[model samples]
Target: MMYKSTLSVKKEIALHLLFWVIWVYFTLAVVDANGIHFAEMDLFSSTWCITYVVTFYVNYLFVLPKVFHPFKWIKAIAGLVVIFLFFAALRYFLEQFLTVQLFNVQNYNPGTGILYYIYDNTFYAARPIILSSAFWLIVLLVRLLDYNKYIIEEQKNTEIKFLKAQINPHFVFNTLNNIYSMVHFQSPNALPAIEKLSSIMRFTTYEAPRNFIRLGEELNYIHAYLELEELRHYDKSFVSWETTVQSDNHEIPPYLLSPLVENALKHGSYTAEIPIIIRLSCNDQQLDFEVINRIGNQKKDKLGGIGIDNLKNRLEILYPEKHTLQTTEQEGLFSAHLVIYFQ
Candidate 1:
């Protein structure tokens, strides 16, 4: 922390030096353009620049922050009045007294009234006052924007972690229930189902926690889950899945696809006549997935199993406007279609 603070201070000092350097160059340019002799203008411009720098820092360091708070406009006005007077008095002392005594030149007429001198210098003081305040305001705005971006990024990561955490337990609970049913029936498929469960659990434990995984790894998990489900139902032909991929190296959010499969198996009806239909096709541009199933005799909530709301939230966070998920029920069939465009 101390190192960072030192670095920040160094940068700030560099910026201030840069500002003054540029100001000096421009002031000299203007003075020379006015046809003043170079040697005399050096003395005048040096005094003027020094006075402007003092005015700039006085308001910056002492006045603006204290007076510029919310509900302090009256204080701000008073503060500016104080700065204007200070600037005029300081300039009068240096230019009228010191410069005249040393170089025999005075910026103002020797006999000018005090009020007119103060009023006339207002025009000069306005530049340093306004520019310095503007610089402060710009720095404050940029800091605020950086802090806001940091806060947003933190919130996004926290929510995604929460949503990812929810998926694993939900999937494990349903899979365990299927295994329990097979074990209670003393079915021959119980041992194979348990083995399949081990593979699924390994993926969920180790791989699923990552933000992304190889698309082929997720597909392998899906294949294991389907085989386990087939053993439970005692029918390999009742579920159909077709996948065409341009490459297996594409990355995907872990467990993103499994919920659709789980939802179908949990709520869908299966028979030789009308099997559950799952289709997926992926290319460099996008991924397309669809699942269709026959409606069963059992009542099912469209948004129930695997929680469509949860799925929708994850999709919105991960893909934003780049993906679409649509579901519809018509003519004894329920279907879900998902399309995700890669960035």
Candidate 2:
């Protein structure tokens, strides 16, 4: 924290110094005179530029921040007026008293009235303060954008964590129930189910925390899960899994594709004619996945659950406009089709 704050302060100081150096250089560039007269005028201009610098920094560093608050337009205007008066006073003292006393020279005639002198100086003195306000506004806008970006990223990470937390327990509870059923019956599949559960638990506990994993790794998890489901149903022929991947180098968010499969398994009617069909295809630029199953009348009402809802949230956050998910029921068939475009 201290290091970041110190770095920020250093950057601000550097920016201020650069601004002043550029301002002074440009002020000297437009002098339009030659030799001895130019030397006198150059000194005069440099002295006046110092006063302008003071005026600019005073307003920028102290006055503008205080006055540009909520319902403070009156204060802001008043602050500008005070800065203008302060600038006129500084110029008046320099041109009238100090220059006269030191070098017996003054830029203005001794007979010029104070009010007229001040009125004349307003146009010249206003430049620095106006630029200071502009500079301050630009800096404020940049900081606001940075802070907004920080806040959005933080919220996205928090939401992803929350969804993952919700998904893990929901998954573990369902799998544990499946294992309990096999154990209660004292079936030979109990040990295999326990092993499958161990593989799944390792994936969820260790690998799920990553933002993304290789496509093949996630596919392996899905394969293990499907095997576990087959053990649960005591029928290895109830699911048909197909994949056509040109390469396995692609990456995807962990556990993104499993909820659709889970929903289909929980609600699908298993028959020889219409077994649960899951198809996955991946290319260099896109991933296409579909889950099609015969809908059971008894489980149709429970079609959408926490898993699907959680998947929706994760998809919105992780993929945004780069993906599409469609779920529909047609002719006693429920299907979910998901496609994600890679860039």
Candidate 3:
């Protein structure tokens, strides 16, 4: 696989849980002013846990978003005001409940201490908001990653469609036009060339849709295409194609290399007097190929790649940071150079 999935959600959750555990410990220590040790108490008491859940649900699901996002400012602030009064009444009753549970009395008040109100309402309530923010941040990251994956897939599909569209007609038109020209010239080898064309089309139409193909199969397709080119231009000056592929067991994206040769035949050897030379050299880890052609009056556009920008885009999107493509123009002749990662 060219793409690897990134960090998962559970890992992020575990990390957040660790941070929250530490913060809760430190927060309680600060609230107690070192008078109580967390190691000696059950922090998950019903009163504490209920309050935690309530604050977390309200802030995470409603309050913070209403405060932070737009158009809900007035409504959210008003809701917070109502919530503040409700909490004031609720805290008054909850203290009575705790008094009954732990002290056998339903009437008591911890009054005239500003710290108690600030600690209970403000800092403690902020816990769920903080935790949900972390979770939502992870959600945002995952969504962005998924969006990027979608974009890459779209670009790849478009590139493949363009390459398939460009090369199919280009190769066929050249072959058919060659046969058409040969039929008038009374060449004896025209029928066999057409048969080779059939084989080439068979592979393309049947197999090229696959994502990966054996290097040997791709090279065979190249050989079939080159044979058709040779048959079509038998009378043209000597043009030689030599492919010395080192490794055959690996797989690569199909039809990626065929366009280079097709371009060479279409443009490089358009004229009869000058020969176009193409060679494929490969190692266990890399494939290097080059095509050189003589410029002619009616030459196909040397801007390159089978009449579509798809080839360049494919090489870049699929093999970027792994492959290299360079085009150099010198002495009225043009060449396309490619190095594809093989291993």
Candidate 4:
């Protein structure tokens, strides 16, 4: 917390210095163009620059916050008017003192009486207020943009958490049902199935909680799930798993690809002669995952179920335009193809 606060203070100081440097450069250039002596121009510009800086910081630190509060609109407006008038008077007096008293600038017009003096210098006094208001507007704009960025990040995190909660319960229920079926049949594979279930539970409970995990970790989880399914069906089901991963270092959203494999096994026809084929390939730039299964007489829903719908929502949130998902049903074959592009 302290480190971040110190960094913020440093940035503010740097920005303040940059603004003042630019102001000084422009002020000197205008004075020089007016054919004033270099020394006189320097002194004159420096004096008014202080007043401008003071006006800006005072309004920015105090008055601007009050002005932004909708409930204090009337009081804030009155305060702003008072602040402008006070600074304007100060600027007028300082200019007069520096030019007439210090520099004795010739042909300096001193208007008749206090009324004429106020009238003539009123616009000059308002210069600082106008410049300060412009600066305040810019500061407010930057702060608003930062606030919007923060809101978007928070929303994304909330959505991810909700999705994970939904996935875990659904996954556990399905896996438990598969295990129960194997035990009822008095299959010898039941013990090995329980061991694979332990590994799946560990991955889902631990790794799935994170926003992102290595592509390899997700693939390992998928392999474990497929192994568990193999024990349940035995020789009744056949799965052809092919993978060509160029690198395991790539990062992806956790449990992203598992749903596609799960959907394929759940809906696939074990009675069919052909085996269910699950193909996954990845290179440096893109990942291609395709799952094909025989439909038999069962009607396949192209839009998919809760798990697939959840997967789509997560893909949209995490990958957006970077991913493509296509489902095609040709003859009795149902295929789901997904391609994800790395940034």
* Predicted structure with the largest TM-score when compared to the true one: 2
Q: To one decimal, what is the Cα RMSD in angstroms of model 1 from the true structure? A: 4.1
Runs of candidate 1 with Cα error greater than 4 angstroms are 1-18, 30-44, 67-75, 85-114, 304-306
- Cand. 4 Cα-lDDT: 0.76
Tens digit per residue, CA lDDT, model 4, 163-236: 88888888888888889999999889889889988998998888998888999899888887877888877763
User: Candidate order by TM-score, highest to lowest?
Assistant: 2, 1, 4, 3
Give per-model TM-scores: 0.82, 0.87, 0.71, 0.81
lDDT of 1 by residue, 201-284 (tens): 899889988889988998899889888888988988887878899897889988777778777877888876799898999999
Q: For residue 124, what is the lDDT in candidate 3? A: 48
Candidate 3: what lDDT? 0.67
In model 4, where do residues sit more than 4 Å from their true spots? 1-7, 28-38, 41-51, 71-80, 89-118, 296-299
The best-first sequence of candidates by lDDT reads 2, 1, 4, 3
Candidate-wise lDDT, in order: 0.82, 0.84, 0.67, 0.76
**Best lDDT goes to which candidate?**
2
Runs of candidate 3 exceeding 4 Å displacement:
1-45, 61-93, 96-120, 150-158, 180-190, 270-274, 305-308, 341-343
Q: Is candidate 1 or candidate 4 better by TM-score?
A: 1
lDDT at 294 for candidate 2?
90
* Tens-digit lDDT string for candidate 3 (1-343): 3544455567656865786687568755444566756554452344555565565556555665566555476875685665454444455456556556776654335454646664566654555546655555565578678779877787778777777677667767777887887788988888888888888788879777777888788878877777776776674344666779667756777777777766666666455455667778878779887877765557553755554366777677678788887777677677888888855
- The superposed Cα distance between candidate 3 and the true structure at residue 97, in angstroms, equals 6.9
Candidate 4 differs from the real structure by a C-alpha RMSD in angstroms, to one decimal, of 4.4
Model 2 Cα lDDT, one tens digit per residue, 1-343:
1112222667878888898777656655445555322233554686687788888889898888888765377898899889998888888788777888888888789799978898898998889889999998878777777777777887898899999888888888989999999999998999999999999999998889998988887887887888888897888888887989999779898888899888987888876567999999999889999999998978682447888899998999999999999988899898999999997
